[model samples]
Target: MSTHVVVGVDGSVPATEAVEWAAADARRRGLDLRLVHVGPQWLHEGDAGHCARALEEAAGRARAVADGVKVTTEVLSGNVVEELIRESAAADALVLGSRGLGGFAGMMVGSVSLAVAGHAAGPVVVVRTAGAAGAAGASGHGTVVVGHDGSDDSRAAMEYAVEQARARHARLHVVSAWQLPVFSPYAVAYSGLVEDVVREEQAAARERVTPWRQANPDLVITDEQPCAHPVSALMDAAATADLVVVGSRGRGGFASAVLGSVGHGVLHHVTCPVAVVRPRQEDRA
Candidate 1:
């Protein structure tokens, strides 16, 4: 495991907010903080001073959040996604703003943040502006949500979620959302069968978390298997969450999507800070 947290900094409001969140998390995890500024090769040719200033200012913001934390800054010249992905390989977690200016700029959650979340190793946290909750950062809501669908990735997500809950002394909610498979128009006769399958799925979902609950007897762990879309179920749970976590991929509704359909949707919709945890290389298979 790495000993520090790396945050992409571009001096945008969202990026600044991300620095704050990353710094706080670094302190909580007893890790150092590193501020990174990445830009295209062409931009770097003429923006040397600007890059330094951006990194310096971001480092200051990070220091303000945790004065005792050691902070460092670096300027990289290359494709934003590629450099950040490389950075993620050696960091405990890679943090980025949901949207940014300059190199990190885009609409809504932004393409860069989503792309990195999909490919980065370890955990990639996308911290959005305070739009949904009128404030950003982990606001001590005392709840953390994670989406699990019995896949390896989901299992990894649960591990990360459990650690986060323990760190914050928050509740952990594992959500498994399911839906009936598409049937032919004349398949109404299979209604009873559909109900049976739904019940089975719900039971399996609950069973998946049973071991976790038993092992962490002191921690408040809860599991919900709802007959609904994964994104909707997670969003509903996130409405009162301080942080929401999801894996890079999963089964069923999530499929093996780059970031998993559910994870991508949650990042765009969840009000709380979101963490996308990718399983280690050995566990990817």
Candidate 2:
């Protein structure tokens, strides 16, 4: 089956904004758009009409603004989380607003969006509403920011990031971060060793991305500082980037951990859209 992007909407302002963002991304990637509105199965029989109207409105707006992109809408009956995750299995990327109208009020992050971002097999994008909660109003609008940590999943995220950059004809900024050993703070003897380790990590991360830069000659790969805390570094880059990408699981996680710390942090903090990528099956084991 041809790949397409799926976006969940609830007829809220943020949800409509998310559809618009997903529509543009789908158009740029030459992918079709699927707009999903999930409701509880038989919760309120009369609610079906409301759901249909909302989805139809979203689809209409998507078609009007996103030219050349195939747009389709579905009003699904089931638990919202399960249905969205089900759709995610076949989607290239799942997109949603950071908060949902039915989930919470005046909250920066909603429960459903967090659940999908944590468990989706592929990448999941969380976009905030316009203003300070949304993508930064910074000068650089077409820049893509991706985080790397030398993990297999991170490599997968980088591959996706490169594709996104190429699709948007945008510059790619790769950021890698490393921390000093925990013992360094308490043991003066280990300070020098920690310093050496930090330097080694910095060099290794920089070297790890060298081939990616070489491979994507068409993308302007900007070298970013790799020594800051992973979350802070990525959030800083997001301040001006159009999108920020990270691996679903990082090097520090157990095999069963669904979402790594860095990915969760970026999802919560970045003003710009954040995509969390999972490594392929073969790469994970």
Clashing pairs for model 1 are none
Per-residue lDDT tens digits for candidate 2, residues 98-169, read 877642223246367767777777788888747322222223477889887667778888988998889877
Give the Cα lDDT of each candidate: 0.82, 0.75
What are the root-mean-square deviations of the candidates from the true structure over C-alphas?
Answer: 2.4, 3.4
Q: What is the lDDT of candidate 2?
A: 0.75
Error of 1 at 49 (Å): 1.5
lDDT of 1 at 83: 93
Please identify model 2 stretches exceeding 4 Å from their true place: 43-45, 102-110, 131-140, 184-191, 252-260, 282-285
- Error at 115, model 2, angstroms: 1.3
lDDT minimum window of 10 residues, candidate 1? 130-139
Q: Roughly what TM-score does model 2 have, to 2 decimal places?
A: 0.88
lDDT winner among the candidates? Answer: 1
